[model samples]
Target: MPYIPLEDHLPGITGLLEYSKDTAAPIRELTQTLLRGPSTLTEGERELIATIVSHRNQCTFCVTAHTAAADILLGEEETSTKVKQDISTAPVSDKMKALLTIASLAQESGKSVTPESVQKAKDAGATDIEIHDTVLIAALFCLYNRYVDGLSTVTPTDPAFYKGLGERLKNNGYNRLPEGYEHLKK
Candidate 1:
């Protein structure tokens, strides 16, 4: 059970967001902009940043949800898995590898992000915006991972639940909860 009362039907961050729509609004907007907004980074790449951070934090819900989203956007499940296991060997471009390195450092500690990492990303063709977004996405997911785990929110074990969530995230872009889930807001 969650540490606080949360809708059982709405697992993980969804329940938490519904528990507080006022707070959820800014979070949803930020998430939408970072993950789905126009940028040089592909949606898959952004989701990969989220996945790596959540995985490092050991937040199962966020990791699985974002892994699904990354898989869907990238059209391959292996890439996310590969990245979580080892970014160096993952089949992404050099720029992505370097950016993910920066993200990982940010996950550890904002201060851990060395100038060398930034330089590596730039050398690999990462624009300043890409580097900026990678670190921000990493920092954001760190907050999210802690929030969900801290609250002990419901974390569904079903793969089907995550699949549906991935589809919704891909199609809806996090502006609001899906239509059927409105009951959570009450």
Candidate 2:
């Protein structure tokens, strides 16, 4: 059960968003722009950043949801698993690894991000925008992880739910909750 009442059908951040559409709008918009918007980083790479941050934060719902999204966008499940297990050994390109390192540092703390890590990413071909986005995404997801877990939102155990969510995220991005979930806002 959530710390506060929430829709039974909706889980994780969905429930929290439904609890307040006013707040959800900007959150959704920013998430859509960052993850789905045009950038050199693929959606898969961005989702991997989210997954790793959620994993580090121990936010179960986010970890599962983004892992599924990463798997779908990247066309492989193992990449997420490997990243969660160890980014150094993950099969992503050198640029991705460097970006991920920066993301990880951001997860630890904004100040934890170092010049060396930024340099490493640039050396691996990460643009100024890529470096900027990686840190922002990491920071955003940290807030998200805390928001979801802090409220004690529903976290479904069913793998099928996450798989479907992954597909929806891959196709729809985060612009809005899917139809039928809007009733809660009334």
**The candidate that achieves the highest lDDT relative to the unseen native structure:** 1
- Model 1 agreement with the true structure over 29-134: per-residue lDDT tens digits: 9999999999999999999999999999999999999999999999999899999999999989999999999999999999999999999999999999999999
Model 1 worst lDDT window (10 residues):
177-186
Q: 103, model 2: CA deviation in Å?
A: 0.6
The local lDDT score (0 to 100) that residue 40 gets in candidate 2 is: 92
For model 1, name the residue pairs that clash. Answer: none
TM-score of each: 0.96, 0.96
Kindly list the per-residue Cα lDDT of model 2 for residues 103-124, writing each as its tens digit. 9999999999999999999999
The CA lDDT of each predicted structure is: 0.92, 0.92
> What shift in Å separates residue 99 of candidate 1 from its native position after superposition?
0.5
